[model samples]
Target: MKKEKTVTMGVDERYSQWKSMVGVLYDWLANHNLVWPSLSCRWGPLLEQATYKNRHRLYLSEQTDGSVPNTLVVANVEVVKPRVAAAEHISQFNEEARSPFVKKYKTIIHPGEVNRIRELPQNSKIVATHTDIPEVYIWDLETQPNRQALLGAATSRPDLVLTGHDDIAEYALAMCPTEPFVLSGGKDKYVVLWSVQDHISSLAAEAGSNVKMGSKNSQKATESPSVGPRGIFQGHTDTVEDVQFCTSSALEFCSVGDDSCLIFWDARVGSLPAAKVDKVHDGDIHCVDWNPHDINFILTGSADNTVKMFDRRKLSSEGVGSPVYKFEGHEAAILSVQWCPDKSSVFGSSAEDGYLNIWDHEKVGETSGSGGPKGANAPPGLLFRHAGHRDKVVDFHWNPSEPWTIVSVSDDCDSTNGGGTLQVWRMIDLIYRPENEVLAELDSYRTQILGTTP
Candidate 1:
């Protein structure tokens, strides 16, 4: 007994000594202003010689995510600036289009800079952003500045406004498919639809024709646009998570929430939901999106680690029939799910597991060279995956005009803010590359660097 106790004490002492030494080293590093390097991060490369040294070798790829691309880097930028007048065609596409339009920017974000305003274009005038608090900000890359707008609650308390949400809780926001209305859901358990055109027209009416685009004096003329609520649909018993307009009609929309229910609302109807189902899932519904091609079809991601497809006609406030299709391969919460804008059978899901998984509901499974799927209904096998994020994926969307392109954002490791990046990735590269080929390429890259596969 004595011998054993002595041995345990020696081991504990050694561990304590090692821990203390490590703490000392850590403190020393902190004192010297050192930080461990991260795998990757989003950065905009500047073309100006003064912006970043050694610029000739590589152009800062537009908004490239912090991923080691197979060959090159590309990035995209979401600039926060005042609106400009509707103008001639200014395409924001690949590098070819960037050269002509991006050159007009006065202040260019640099490598060492965060989202700070380092400079502005020569002709640009700064606009004040005091009273114009926005709840949700959306920028249409295709039309960009022309369609850029803000959304906020009409009845707001300055003390209660959160950065991205109004009131106590924010559930969802969706743009109308064919109309000028925007729908928003909240912890208040009400879905409100606001007319976009009305907000703009009312703002213009207030400006009294004195507002000039990009003019210094225009800030006073175009104060906060009154975004009074248009129509309110009330039915949910819990917090709303997502709300989306049905693709086929402007009069219809859908919402989901922590109540483990989904409700369909009609803008033209009463406060009651047009359709509702509280038994679709065993957990909170995190997101819901209508199929772009099918009005009856909608896809939902839930906290139960599953994605369910519902046929709206078969569901009501009472109950629902068997789902049209169900997917259950995610090991963590399904945070975001989106149907491919082009393909009816194809779609994608982003989860807390840090993977972007693609699926085709019509296909039972797919066989890779590794082997066939272990089960007939094993979630159709991942068509491809993007596991580059280091944390939970918060949301994602397919580029409005680009079918094969997608963008995903996630929660940061600290959970203090978002993934802190707006990354762009190509679905084609992930879908087409065979497993073996991808492995070989990754292995080659590792060997070329460290002389061993990582």
Candidate 2:
């Protein structure tokens, strides 16, 4: 019995490693070989369902009691949805469309409630936040079931505003993990800092905020700009793709861009990079992220088809100038990468290949054989590969509450497949024991410098 158990465990480990290796190959083929877009599953059906009703964004927030909270954020584009423009497009699709299915498909999320939303802390609210091209807002999940936007409750207000690029916002905004401040970045080539107090007040005074293309709401009716932002951070040569604050320190943050540079910033001091490495990737560095458990570590994904990890502590040392570990396998550009929060040494990367490559740290030598090990004991080795996307994957988001769930976004074609589609993967289904209890408490108490939350 003992021997049999050991064999089973070994097979599982080997399989995990193989999956990662295979994923790299798939990414390479999808990116470089130019697979027919028609070869993948069509996203038209799913996207139509998502946008049928008046919904633009959907979010799931789980309660502590195991019940889940789901909310939809709708942008009132003069009614009849944005695509309809007038009643003509709506009528045409209904009458001339090839498909004959019409249910509240928009309301019912396929694959149902996401596993990433495990449970919210006691009394903690599930908030859905968005911005109107230039303006940012948050919606309280605890409010009415009608899914109203929380106009007055945002934690921050941005001094800089950019609606979107090519019809979509190429960047995303995030609330600093520790403060009421908000961080906004995108193809605009600048990362702007927002003040928390200012955001809440602006929403309260104005019934609704209009996010224009170039101008800001400088004219306040009654309140000032909540001490305003310290100042805007502008250094990226290209569009700022991503930004993240250190989980352990508030003053430390990171930003990556198309210029092939990953810059570390000290919010308390200078505007220039405290530390920077130029040409960090062969191509644009589209994504940068900090390890949730280890603040000193960071990850970057690039158009070079590789993911690299850097140890800040090591980078800050006397003369070290290169990444501590580099993982290479994908053939095409990598759009996104994330570290698994629930477990250490588990990370994933997504690419144009429409697959996810799970990785682990190891040290191994190059072997003159059929191919490299799917996963090895080096700085980064492929562990698992999940193929789910049908086209070029543009974004990947990991669930904070669930251990193995990941949500991805990709551009489909026009008509039913136009715009984009979201892919939710219940990775737990591929794991061993599936019933691990998720605890909300952290292993150590980190200082909360900004927010009023206890």
Candidate 3:
């Protein structure tokens, strides 16, 4: 108990220190308090772009206390542009108070606790959700009527259901970037795939209409459509933890699992894995992502407290695969790993240690003097550490529309007076910009401040 208390105190101190440096470290930040913990978070489409700020749709889940049904929340978030927020006022936020920047737009009373949410890249309003069930639920956000989340509310029916898994598939979910395809991994030790090509036109038509689809009390709300898996790949000896489709190809995808294996699948060939890497990690692999810009590079985070980067060209079906680089920065098991949308060489990893670390693989062997974190013992390529969350950062997503922006959620209900913390932040450009460029900018600023001609 004493040791645990000490650890908690240390975390509090680090968070306090980070809070003090927020004005200097972040260009923009919004801390919104959530009423319940969210296991997953994903940014939807940008709704509007104004001069000072942009309005975006945000998707998140509310794990409720059973007094009210769990829900998938659609929220509108106003993101302040760079240099628009006053530095001194940016850090002045109350932990328990909700930010004015976020407003609830719609609520879907989900059938169960939503474990994961993934928006289709082709149409952001189309989403796939996983629960403590074998099937995956699909929703058309534009057509779904907004419902008030109250006690004893009827569960919102999904527009479509993807059924295949024989056991609960709680977390692993992904949507194809090139097509309206969905993929999920389950405790049944199987990876399931489904394509919504047949329903896309109907959904698009419904979204364009002014009529709302259904109400909570409507029993004749048209029979919900259901689809079967196009392919069910089996290779993992244990539960598959996460999955991701290749950015450019809907036919190719990959999955990581508790079996410590990484399996790549090619739907064009067959359901069996085209290439399998046995024992890719020392522990259960929790997350995996294929680089969008460089399709050859893939990243996986594991229970071994490491994130490994692998080149697809080197992986084969024959032997244990070798990672090009192993990032050992997190103190606890990593839960999420995602490549930055704007930077091919950069990525972020979040873990149970209450930290989200940003890394640039291009800076592995360079000596300090770069703008990244500097220490003799610092892990290779670590650029910055975000210590905002008081507990585990379960999930985070990089904003593709906004450079260097991120939305991260933490399951810190126990520490923060019965709720979780959702933060949207972007580090100052000086942190990630080229060293020479930063120096030149600093010199220009100094010349202006001193009232001297440069």
Candidate 4:
């Protein structure tokens, strides 16, 4: 029998080389560690728990440097018996009734769907109660309470919860990035700016209402509160489907709707628009968003299968009819459009076609055209195509903190999640390769040097 001798490398040289490599890798990891986990893996528990909170609430807040971090949860609303009409406002009313998971119970008259939701002024609290009802539920993210106040501020509850003209009551609610006022647009073609100070005053009004409900021995009307409507904005010929407050100017905001026009108003003035884009779209404008990254740029999406970006600086001199850039590719109408908070040149648009188009504004050409951006041989890139929903995607929102993260919700025409479902996806999904070729190259180099697959 013959014995084989094993060869060994210099211990100090090998140890030094491995330690140096680890130090370099550690530095890279320290600078670019992944804060966002794999979308499908980490969000499963959150989505399962979503059954309790029915409504998926995604909240985004801008940091001092202008980056936005987003928070999501099953909206913490009560999951009473299916028969209760109040539960209908949340989600999956009919589906839950038929689902073998829930027990049967009594039912009440159905209420309207959510009109709008907003974060409270000056605090971390968020509210999403209906306008038609007397009660407005308020949730304080700071507290993480099981059940917060169903009734907002102590003031007298509103008698009429307003809805949009075409049954879309939450036509638009614009919150000033730096101020406390939120401008709410309604079905009546009117816009009202609700002041944060006025909201606190509402608390006093609520206390007064409680005193009236109580006997003499009860708590006195704590404080007398006086609130005033900033003024009603009136410009739209039909319902104002969306409204936005300019981040650059606290005194200005814009509204758009079925009219195919975008009306820019100085909120400090009466309802009239300071400027208008009378022909921005050929069809109904579904959504409007101001560029948080570039205060002077505005973007809009329409039912006509088009997305347009207006450079206010250029518009001021070029006139209202011109758009700095227009995008067109979706076979169906665009349902929602949102701009990246970190980069003004990059934006994402979602449509009924079930595809999300990301565009680099810098590369998008400005050639005169009849067919729009996509048809005209423009450089608009298809960042990614996501197709999980069996039906139309209602909304697409970008995670402010994570530039590449987007969350979307859709209707289940086939009742996939029993009725409707919310899906969270990473923009990285559009670009993620299962295997990193660069990492493989590095591994091969190490194998040759170390004489093993280290």
Each model's C-alpha lDDT? Answer: 0.50, 0.47, 0.89, 0.49
**Model 3 lDDT per residue over 233-323, tens place:** 9888999999999999998999999999999999999888889998888999999999999999999999999999999998765945799
lDDT of 4 by residue, 171-194 (tens): 466667677665666567776665
Q: Taking the tens digit of each residue's C-alpha lDDT, what string does model 2 give over 105-187?
A: 22211111111211112212322133224333332232313322232322222232322222222344444656555555556
Off by over 4 Å in 4: 1-111, 120-124, 128-168, 202-228, 316-319, 365-379, 414-418, 429-454
> Candidate 2: lDDT of 370?
18
For residue 268, give model 4's deviation from the true position in Å: 2.9
- Extract clashing residue pairs from model 3: none
Candidate 3 achieves a global lDDT of 0.89
Across 1-454, the per-residue lDDT of candidate 1 in tens digits comes to: 8986685565345434433332211111000000111112222233333321112111111222423111111223322111121111111122111222112122122122111110011111211011112343221111112211112212111111113234433337666657655666777676776654564454457666644232333233333223456677778888777788887788889899989888888767776888778767889998899998888889889999999988877774465556787787777999888888767777889887656677776555454411112324334544645543445665565644433455555545343232232334443232334468867776778867687756
Measured by TM-score, the strongest candidate is: 3
Mark the 10 consecutive residues where model 2 has the least summed lDDT.
28-37
Using TM-score as the measure, name the better of candidate 3 and candidate 4.
3
**Which candidate model has the greater lDDT, 1 or 3?**
3
User: What TM-score quantifies how close candidate 2 is to the native fold?
Assistant: 0.55
